[model samples]
Target: MSSTQPVESEWDGAKYGREESTGVIFGMEADQVIFIAVGVVLGVLVVMINGFPWGLAAAIGLLIVFGGIGIPRIKGNSLIGWARIFFRSKSRQRSGNDQFVQKDDGVEIGFTDDGEVEIVEGPEFEIMDGSVRRGDDTPRDGKNRIRPGKPVRMSLPGEFGELLVYQLPGGGAFIYDPVLKVATMVAEVMTEKAFQLNSFEEKEDRLREWVSVQSTIARIPGVDIVQLSDQTTMISGASIRHWYEEQILKAPAVTTADGETVRQAGPDVDPFMHQSLVETIMSVENQPVHDMWMAVVLSKEKLNERIVAAGGGVAGFMETALSMMGTIENAIPTSGAYVTKWHSPHTLAARTRTAFDPDSAIQVSERGEDGVAVRQAGPMYAAPRDIKTYESDGALHRTYKIAEWPHSQARLGFLDKLVFAGDFRHTVSLYIKPRDTAKALKANERDRATWSSNDKIRDKIGKQQTARKERQIQDLVQEEDEVTAGHAPLKLICVITVTAETDRELNANCADLETRAAEANLDLRVLYGQAEEGFIAGALPFGKLEV
Candidate 1:
């Protein structure tokens, strides 16, 4: 709907950030310089030996050395790292278990390639009747089993009590606690419903304003996680038909959820009304659903430190453990055991035990059919059965990456249609991170300078002129004004998750999502082979950037 204006950032200058990094010497890590030097020497020698073959080899070596391959920078493992995997012998590399790597911050941590922090398992420990005890296989008194009641929003790894933070398996620090997520979510839904009552222009203005605010929210501190919230809506033609038939049969006596007889369609109801209602429901975009997840990542090392620091270390750590449990117990509303995907706070030793022994993965769960708050051991871990399409706990899921944003500036409420568009169940989340104001200004200035230089060059070469450069200049000036006024810029990413009963249904739903997203000024690209990680980054409120 709008023309390309280069003022808008493409990928938020991830490469440019690297260029500006003052880390190490001249924005390059020591490891990087080593790779470059080695590549240069070997490549040049090869070139001297032959000619074309050597030249091509040297070019490739330089590219890998500089990571000149593409944008967004490499996520994990530099280009040289890739070469090492193939070229170096496995025995030459040290095993992750052999030693702890000290980080720049001076914390020792064992890291997996995925970036997840390795949990240090402690000796088997337990609490019996509120008294401290040790030994893993000891019979448990059922009093402290986990219960599924009102869900609690917990700061991650901290919930495990043994850890204060979880340096996400990826690169980033996340504070898992929600300052005000629930209330904000409720308000957003309510506001959307109320928007239908507004005038067209007023609604447009409101939408644009809201979009601006989302930009701001993304810029907040430690807010880089991609958020995805999932919801299910039943709006199929069949369901609509059932409801319509029920209404027709109970016409003039239609009842509410409470069974109160409400006014119904008149006795002379038009037969075509059913067709109209069905069409409306089927055509509705967005298929609005509540209850979505926001992604959160944990600072793993901090969590471990907190756990070890509690009650003044090993001498009084037992008392500290009991005291920590009491404090957390008071915080959570549910009784029995408290379970999380990673570890259970009620069972601190769960992670410690599991770390030492992976065989004992079972935890206290909603055991038996009655579903009472029972203290019974069961497996709650949902290990996916497949990679292409993950099937866990009877649900087939897939994730879509927001590969592109609207080229044209859109109205604020442009997404309202997408919110309730198709007849499906899914989640749409925005992972927002605020960039530092100074950094934002610097990036903006650099981009503007580049554009200005290009404009000058085009003029010097007597090339055809276009307004693109001029528009960029104007935009840069406006952005500068905004930044000067203290409005920090944000780095934002969006994702969508589609759910279905089976593979076929999932594909169908994904198609529907893609179509509806286009209508809503969105461009969704299926994550394809990367469904699980994408789902975790997008669907959960954990602020984890998909590194």
Candidate 2:
């Protein structure tokens, strides 16, 4: 009489799953070196003791220490996390899959095969329209299990155009095109072309002004951009030559295809000797890169409302649409500027490829389970299990919610230290939801009225009115002016995610991040129960304030 109940074994993370994740000490696993050192020390003592049995005892102890006990955990966390990371930092990693999704704090890292690593928020959520089925029912690979439906419903009820938001597992969101950003960038370039600033600083300032202009543009409301990054070892000199030979040279006697080779045809064989030496020089640099992607998102309903406000009649709507089109089209470079195409339309497959295998040409419709069904969604699974932290794919992750913004106001570019921190792996994201101009104006007026009412009450109670309220009044005045001048108002949310190979490293990184936050004048609070949701809303590829 045997029971058929499944044996509930504990999650033994020590069971090596991914060969590449096996951590190292200096250049190798710390276990072997530590074992050797222990044996030597014990042998010396045994020799001093002058007993054969003592030597045997020492040998037995060595076996127990080295073979029996692997890397122990410090209260359920990796004890040798630091040593392992030291080795990983010095070496390379190869994954069979195209995408490796990892999350730490408010940062979610999506690594693609093409060396494009994106740090974003919001874990991908299955489509609510019963399109993406919850996968753990059978043996199937988790990659691309949730296929987005064709003719996906536009969630934001905009008059002009719709905004599409994809909720990822890590609480990061991916958005459709943000019209205002396109419009603003075009506007900035045109303004710069009209006036050629001399220095880089001038150009930067001009761009900064354009950024300000973008903040005020009301083309689309509830808009936000999600950014992600992955650290890729830069191409080596030898690898570059090999790629060049394969991709460009083709065969010895073949005439080169145009743009195939860095060296042009005829007399331009030598890249250095050619007229495009500057371009060659620019292209020659090979190094490790932290790839970055900024995804634009906006609300559809708000855009349509703005369009409706432009005119109720069809002619007026058409006129407004044409004007918006003109703004985007005229924004294109007509002069000697670089031309870059927008990303492909296969958003789901494209994102999957970026995350999984860079070379995959799999269509979105073709993507499905790969014979290894997941029990529960990874990021979404571990979060609720742990109170203080979440662990996934052998790495510990936590979410840091932005508790406070800068109290002492700083100028633009104040985040230089935190953003440009060269050491460690991390992701920074800002979610900006635009407010409609008319409603924003009404809110401002209501706020002012409320302030007046509060000020009288305070005066009657014999309390001194604070400077903060006064400043608010001043801010509203400026805000009104900017709105009148076609500037947009946006609600902003910011978060940072830090990644480490183990718990020890994670703890150390938390300290460093805290210090950086203090310097940046940001108050980052570790999310208690909101780890999963925070990652989706703040760190994924799209920004969803609703999370």
Candidate 3:
């Protein structure tokens, strides 16, 4: 179960997963090498046709312009790479995809048949005496005409649009998009024993169990794991006030000497004890609580066969999910966790509302359990951004991706510092995608070929490979061997999102976040120009990344 031994024998340890660079020759990317070769060939042709000095000067100019300016890395990407990103960002902006503005009128928020939001303008026909009438037109019964508007409904921007979320009967939720034909299962994960506090034997057992879980998940083709942590700070007296009120309600009535009924405000001897307790609690500082959720993302077609076999409706989907959930529930230990499934549509609405607008209070609806009015769940306003952070109602969010992980071996709970960094609101998410076994093996062989070619090029040029490159080669060889031995190949990405009510607070939290991540030996890069996508990937149980 253990791949890397612990530095100290008292703890369980594992090396961070590293992906080998696939440079073809002379430690340069394939594109770079191609450009250089093209320039050389052109210069040789010119020399054959013209003269030595002109061709040589042209060749030197091309080398200086292309190889000199484009080869060196800047902020983990080359100049050409940055140019590509810049053009992509500008293209998105020009297409009006970077910003979203909700329709001002409630009458224009209806959805078309294909799930696109329809915004139209027209004069209202007032209903009088049970009939809607227009000037000099025949009056028609209002009940007979289909209303062309959906109340307070608008589509979320980008990939979040056209989403439909359903609460399962037993537990968990199914978040799907009809247009995209993608489905995801989201479930909360209950707290488990602290890995750092466990004994050496317990640590080994835990690691073994985790390996088994990974193996089980890896067997599901085209699957990705999304683990999210939503940390909220409790600075208000709502909990204390609710407790005080509950105590007052539960206080037993006492009969006075005169046989009159008398009820105290609190259970204690002092009638105002609950009030005092509330005040004391309010005086203290805020506390942070973390909620963890794990989501499994899959293509809708993957589950279609099972759903059809089970009879193909809500019941059929539920049955299929229940069977699938058995493996997931056991692996993650979902007991005591709030699974987000509700028997009532009103509850689902409340959960959705809170998910999009954290500052908004959840209002209980009087609607029945039949179906949810999705309009009630969406946020009133959203300001999308192509930059670092965006506003979705009252909160500002900034997301960061783990550009570099710890190179040195550490304890099992090395991420605890980064997760529990500051007392501010934030979320830490991990996305794991298990690769297809055959494809992974083929890719590994191709990488070996590339490395061999690179080695030959380096030897011809009398340049020795760097120590880091040698280590990476050895690691790749070991990984290839492991895959041959039936170990699953996986790609993982870590995203962190920090949330705040204002800019100042958000900046302060982000600074603190960077410090904590550095302590954990993680290099965090802000997901600039992909803020909305990053927020969705990091802060929600939506299995997505900014690539």
Number of clashes in every candidate structure? 47, 65, 0
Greater lDDT among 1 and 3 belongs to: 3
Stretches of candidate 1 above 4 Å error?
1-43, 51-189, 192-197, 208-230, 233-289, 292-388, 447-481
For residues 1-547, write the lDDT of model 1, one tens digit per residue.
9997644332232110111222233234557666566666766666776678767677667666455522112433345544544343222223322111211232222223233454333212223443334222212226532111112122111112112222111111112222221111100112233566676655555645554545544443333333434344432344444455666776666567887775556233554875677777656433333433333332223234443554222212222233333333232222111212222222322222221122332221111111111011112332233433544335566777665556465544455555555566666666655577888899888766666665566678887654543544565776777779765575656667666667888888887777778887676666543444555454434444452
**Candidate 2: 10-residue stretch with minimal lDDT:** 12-21
**Per-residue lDDT of 1-547 in model 2, one digit per residue for the tens?**
8978743322211111111112233122456557556766776676567667777677667656654344454322243543554343223222212123432354333432122444445333333323444433212125423222111212211111222333222212223333332111111111224223334454455555545544533353333332222222233334334434454444334345654444343234665443354445346545333433334443334356654564432222222333443343343233222113222222332332222221222222223222111111122212222544544444455557566666554434445445554465555665555676788899778656666676676788898855655655666676677668775665556666655557788788778878878887777777554444444443334334433
Using Cα atoms with residue i matched to residue i, what is each candidate's TM-score against the true structure?
Answer: 0.46, 0.46, 0.75
Please provide, for model 3 over 225-344, each residue's C-alpha lDDT reduced to its tens digit, 9 standing for 90 to 100.
Answer: 545455443433454455557767777888888997766765445647756777776775443556566777765566678767766543455456656766666654422233433222
Query: What is candidate 3's TM-score against the reference?
Result: 0.75
Q: How far off is residue 287 in model 3, in Å?
A: 4.4
TM-score of 2: 0.46
Candidate 3, residue 379: Cα displacement in angstroms equals: 4.3
